[model samples]
Target: MTADARPWTAPVAAGPVTATVRLPGSKSMTARAVVLSALADSPAEILRPLRARDTTLMADGLRALGTRIDTSDPERWTIEPGALRGPATIDVGLAGTVMRFAPPVAALAAGTVTFDGDPHARNRPLRPIIDALRTLGADIDASPSGGLPLVVRGTGTLPGGPAVIDASASSQFVSGLLLSAPRFAKGLTLRHEGPPVPSAPHLRMTTHMLRAAGAVVDESEPDRWVVEPGPTQGRVWTIEPDLSGAAPFFAAALVTGGSVTLGGWPRDSWQPVDTLTGLLTALGAEVTQNDDGLTVRGTGVLHGIDADLSEVSELTPVLAALAALADSPSSLRGVAHIRGHETDRIAALARELNKVGAGIVEHPDGLDITPRPLHAASFETYADHRMAHAAAVLGLAVEGIRLTDVACTSKTLPEFPELWAGLVTGS
Candidate 1:
């Protein structure tokens, strides 16, 4: 999915740079919505399913399982619930959600289901899920590395017992477990026994999706939870705009002293959008929200401060980009979970930022970025979506930025560059 990137150099727009850009639906929430809707026994309405590659792949996977979903409109989905009475084979097309979330959803089927994903997704690790399912009486056959190209043969008689899965790797591991908990005969009890669950709010979103579809969830602690069995009731569901997806724009507002209004944002969201707002405000951004999306305006000068982001690792790259312009040194803490994302985000950010002008310190978990006037430079985006995006935005504060083969954003936002063009020179 690498495309020859058109070389772009960021110029300080002497003229006030201003524009209202349209953002995409949240990939995280959209993927969760698809899964929950598939579990519904009746046709469920999913408003504003993201049209990006990830959600499209998920919708396709569900369709292969005989879940009829109407994808005619980009803004809504009508999901017809059904089952995959395999021998069935489906492809996830490079989406982490499908690779991480599909195993257990398939476990509810009465036959063998072969699941595969995109080339990059094929590299994502799945040992935790495989181990957890094995503990829950699921028979899964996959490569020894515990990667993709998975084969799951459901017993259709799983007596769900105690499951203590280590989620130090990915929160999706815990979410996959929670999504499938309702299908088990004996219900579910889970323990997140490794590093604290990274992206913990995603778990909240997962359980929220499950409960909305009809199930009982009891979250006893940050590390443990119990679920009462229930099949999805398949009600009409609505999808809120992605707050995580909105982080970059919010940070953009903070970086250039520019202002942007975000619409379609959710007031009650597990996404760390609100948290990012506090960080921006701390650094001198004026933020406000109403029925529209959050509106953020940046001040000319920003001061560095201490903050932890282990819970919202996906937003780290954009934060790192913003930190480079802060007056003092800024450190992003609690990011060890970044090691397991689409790429080693901590290392990717540190390496790429250093390529231009910023002084960066890389930790196993997080990074520290210092203020610098960015000069024109070429960069490799590491085929990571966030890396491509955060780097481009960083370039906006510089003389210019030239990104090479930077088309990986298609994994989430297919039209990212087109949107960026409007922001740069106001095309």
Candidate 2:
């Protein structure tokens, strides 16, 4: 079941699924922490980091650039700073973190570091980060196509200064710049232009991590960030549980009229996906926080909702799946940028949902999902983890649903199939 190469039948819950799920650490935080550790002056320890495809890819990418990272313990990473020497090749594996975050670090290498990823990753947004790095004095050749199969020729160091970029497509562009800004000789002052950036919480997460690493960052101005040039100080980092990865389990409760509790749910968090707590409540689930964690109990009544998921577009697939089974229509908007994700989420959702007999419309930036009786079908994952999660949630209510590439969930939650199987069946 861990292998995604073959199709896996999505298990149907016989009744309400009641279980306490313990999620892995945040992939977003793990990737960032790895980057920060590599940039630091001394060795640092990252505890409870997610050990999954995406995060492992990031660790491998950093090692390619001459950073010494120890992965002996899957739960902890020991990073030792080293002189960066490249002529290295990084396989991004459709991980947005590896594709977007590594390039900035590559700019500090002495030689050329080439970046490529899965076929689907070639189509995702890479231009903004490449263009922004070029603007800030990094020698990068992306063939002007600005997608992938790119190279960064590091001059040992960069003279970073004021630069302007459009990050409407992916906030990773802005975060990539900020994360590496401190290594620049002159630091950086980046201003964002064009449409408003999606996933503001992620951007904030970057800033918070940077500050925690002893880097000076200023975000007093809208769409502007200022980072002071300096060496990053090493420190121990503890990654929190991934709220985004918990989406499917929560949706399982609502779908099967069950109850589930998530351990290690942060009392205060910048994770945009934490908004799911409210969304679940609005969907006729009772939510309460206890010493154990966050518990959600479904009353067997699911209600459709109108929600703008622009800031937390990662939740779109599962939410869309839930909406398809709701009592009324639901409109999910402000996530056009997701079109450039691992796959075109909006189109994929509509196409796959309709294949199973749901009335879902793809919009310029969102979806309009109308409640319809859903039947089992072979749900295609498109190699995107969230898409796999959607199929799993829908499968709880609709039997005989075979998820093509359930292995894709390993991108974030490596034990997804095992964890999911346990949650529904109490195995």
Candidate 3:
């Protein structure tokens, strides 16, 4: 199912919400894992892979390029590597992973592949990755705006070598190139020559996953990564639960002075759990991890915080919502790159929060939210999943909060509405 045009009335928490949420697999990890599995030396199995729209699109795109992926089993999807050839058209929806990660993989195909997406997707930043691909010897024709609605003319192989990119706009640009580097003829030595790249942890996740798949990678130096040409080994890849998608549930706990536990988290997480813990702890949430899972308990006292969320920018929307309900003021910085996400998050947050009477000052990189008396209002999601999560968190305390389209959450979490209702009702 796609996004529903009907507006959704967000549920308000009658009391402190207490529940354990079992979220799906991480979209980022699943996307990268699927790509690697398709390019592996042998057939591979991705255990508990995310079946969300974004990941499904990635799988479909790979299938168009002749990779055999059997996703009939929801729990375990199998992949068989084949000759990457394409004379296909790919619809990326609003997924950054599909827009960025799939292009490099498509470059390895034998025919031309036309790429497009939702209307807003054409506005996302794609030039950096497109230019980087060209630097490494791939034929691409981007739109006049240097964004999406482009075509990749593949010649069966890529002459990958040293390349430079300005990835300050999005970390996916770097990860995209690195994910497909091992398949290139000469491998890749990528260097970043711009402002500090956002989402450092995501880049680490990319490198870690690559190395785990038997690719030789060197990240000894800052802003530089060297990937030696080799075959990625097919193995059983168990995807971690999406910590980012769980942010709204955790925020619900914090907002209602309740508790929430997320199950199936790995002992050592590839996601930015440390950063999330620190941010939530700073806002008066007690976080603990053990055999059961990761639990966050609210003390009924929400404190304001000043944080730079560059590395974990994906958490900005929900964190910003928490800031709106804090006792004092909060300032979030170092996420200017989010302007190119599904929407201009900073502006959208400021506009919507302020519409409900929250005092917010929009900055180039982030927002400063001051606690105010919030009331009922219609929150616009702008077709962004994270924005819907933020609205849900705010609705827990502020009654009558409605979302323009809760179905937008289907982009990452299709079960958001049911799960959120259960959390509020303690089902």
Candidate 4:
């Protein structure tokens, strides 16, 4: 069970699994809150922040920029915003949030902040954030090849006025800009022009958090946001359970002909996976939400669903796995941008599913899955957490399915294998 050392065989369910799975803090919300807290005018407290590889890197990056983060209790952090000064280096690993979000903050530091990551991390998009920062008057030096191994010359200030960026590659580009925009002299008015930003709900999450922290954000117009600059107020921020991380567990209900309950489901929230409840319902699962949380029960009959997961692209892998196990066909559309995620999700999903004897067609933008008798096979996780999640969900029904690099789930859900084992065994 060591990290990055072994390929684990996913366990198969016997009859029906009945368990309540508690997930860790939200990766999306944790990253955003940490970045915003670091940029706040005063120290702030974050309760239940995710202590995973990605979020830890973000905290380290902020600390490198002279933010005093007290992680004595890793879940509860009291972050004291200090004068931004960094003649330091940040290892972003493969976390897009750390790579994209930290740079803008680094742009406002007193000294240079050098950023790099794993070899694969260097291939993820950074030019959009780099170009946008340069447009907003921040001095940066980067390789001609596009990403990573770059230095931000932080003179401790940024002249952020108006800028336009093509955020179609990743919405993190837009959120990164706005997260650090309040520190700029003129605030910021940003316009995103492209073939629609993928994960639109993430942008809305950014807007909500910004507004909650006392930043004036106007997203009234299409593809444009206006933020009036002022000192960001620090407050007590509470992190939520990651709904995207809860996806595989909820899906376990369907694949095993069982029931799964997830605690702490937000009554009203902008997390993209809130839409998943309806998706589960359409796929022949009884979904219920109440004061306790959300519960999903499978009737042993799963139907395929045609879904537009562009706004909640992270859920695509788990959904695709379910589609492969359904009685009919499923079409998932509007997520071409996902090809640029942790891995080329479309290609990876198609290849891996087919290896296990399922029918999945990789489209330019999404996937078309037709149910087939899936056989046991080794599922390769391309170092993608969701990829591992998909395989784990499938393994619930199909035996002899070994998942390689299962430790990649540490990117968000650090205790994934252990938690999944507990759920499967109900011990």
In order, what lDDT does every prediction score?
0.76, 0.90, 0.94, 0.90
**Top-TM-score candidate index:** 3
Off by over 4 Å in 4: 1-3
Candidate 1 has an lDDT of 0.76
Q: lDDT rank, highest first? A: 3, 4, 2, 1
CA RMSD (A), model 4: 1.5
TM-score of each: 0.94, 0.97, 0.99, 0.98
Instruction: Candidate 4: count the clashes.
Output: 0
Per-residue lDDT tens digits for candidate 3, residues 65-147, read 99999999989999999999979899999999999999999999999999999999999999999999999999999999887
**Model 4 C-alpha lDDT per residue in residues 1-427, reported as the tens digit of each score:** 2355469899998878898877778999999999999999988999988889999999999998899998889669899999999798999999999999999999999998999987788778888889989999998988786688889999999999999999998999999999988889999999999899998889999999999999999999999999999988889988988999999998999988899988877787668655788899899899988877889999899999999988889999999999999999999998898888888999999999999988878899998998899898989998999999999999988998898878899999889999999999888
lDDT of 2 by residue, 251-370 (tens): 888888888998987777657645777888888888888778888888899999999888889999999999988999999999999999989999999999999988988899999999
Q: In model 2, what is the error at residue 128, expressed in angstroms?
A: 1.3
lDDT of 1 by residue, 171-290 (tens): 999888888787788889988886677787788888877877788999967688898876768776666666766676676667777887777666776566667788878877888877
Model 4 quality (TM-score): 0.98
Q: Which stretches of candidate 1 lie over 4 Å from their true place?
A: 1-15
Best by lDDT: 3
